[model samples]
Structures are given as structure tokens and as C-alpha cells.
Target: MSRVSDVYLIAHVEDDVGEAVVTGALEAAGVLGKGPGQIKQHHLLCCSTLDGKVPIVRQLEPELHVDGHSGSIDELKRFLPHLLLVREGHTSAASGQTNVGIAASLASYFGL
Candidate 1:
């Protein structure tokens, strides 16, 4: 197989329905293909954490407002694999919360 030229890591904090919807969309868009020269898509389920099942959507809880802690703490841990790629120079960048943001990131990666 050819080396992957790009990889999209999705670390969404949602229930099964949401995951299924996202997967269906990705698959329909051909982003989930695993062929020789396709951009790879990695799906991560983010409902587990050291702090127990801290649903990422609840990161804004007042009780979770600890110093040196941001809302993305759990997300960071969940997406650590993708972050490692950036750190190791395998990925250029990782930033996105919406389709537009993700599209912009991808465009930047491809010099579009």
C-alpha cells in the first residue's frame, strides 16, 4: 500500500446516534476509504477519562474549572494520537470544530 498523504482524526464526544451519523457522512464522502492513496480517517470515541465518564460536552462544568485546565483537556487526551503525529512531524496541524474549520485546515495542508 502507498503511504498515507493525509490523515483526518475525528474525536467527537457524542452518543451512538451521533457517531453513526458522522460515520455515515464520512463514508458517503469517501473520506473513510482505505485504498492505496486515500486520505485516512481515524475515528475516536471520547466518553472515557481519568475523571470518570466526563462527557466532553460537559467540560464547561463549574466544578471542572481547575487551574491549568481548559475545556479541551479531555479532548486533548482523546486526540493524543493525532497530536503525536503533529509532534513527530507526520501531520502538519490539528485544529477544527466544524466542517468549515476542517475544510480550511485541509486546504492549508494541500496548499489550496
Candidate 2:
């Protein structure tokens, strides 16, 4: 089996509604299978455009084994080493933590 690298990009939605939009985008892009407990099993890369979402992403870092998180593509691109583009939304009304899980799963699948 081949290992895949998990990569996730987060965007703030117009309101709190962005969480679903972002999640859908990630899922559509092939980032999925991240439940709650699986968070600690893989490496994660997270990118977001919302300042408010940063804290949420940060909170998930330890759980997902997050290697990097950035608010801009430039920062994420430069710092992440490997990059994956996800949907766009502003601040998730629900929770963006799942994004980290998605990233981790993808990374593990791709061996990144």
C-alpha cells in the first residue's frame, strides 16, 4: 500500500456557515474519513484565511499532529513544505477541527 500525505486548507465563510462549505469542499477534494478519535493517528497540515479560525486550528494541532498551519496560501505554501488546496469559507460556525482530521487521513493515505 502507498502512504498519502494529508493536506487541508481552511477558509472563513461569509458567516459561521462556512464550516459546512469548507467541509464539503475538503470532502469533494478527496479529504475525508476523519472521525473524532482518529485525530491522533496522522500528520496534519492546515491552512486558513480567517483570523478567528486560527485559534480553532491551533487547538487541534496537537491532536492531529499538525506539522503546519497558516492563514494565507503564501505562508502555508512556504512553511508547509507540501501543500493541498481545499475549499474557501470564512470562520466555521460549527467546528474546523475536522479539517485537521481530514488532512491527517489524506497525509497518511498518500504517505506524506
How do the predictions measure up, each by TM-score?
0.38, 0.30
Candidate 2: residue 4 lDDT (0-100): 38
Could you give candidate 1's per-residue lDDT for residues 46-78 as a string of tens digits?
342334333433432322111112334434444
Q: List the residue pairs that clash in candidate 1.
A: none
Superposition TM-score, candidate 2 onto the true structure: 0.30
Shift in Å, residue 22, candidate 1: 0.5
Which ten contiguous residues of candidate 1 have the minimum total lDDT? 60-69
In terms of lDDT, which candidate is strongest?
Answer: 1
Q: How well does candidate 1 score on lDDT at residue 50?
A: 34
Best by TM-score: 1
Candidate 1 regions with alpha-carbon error over 4 angstroms: 1-8, 39-104
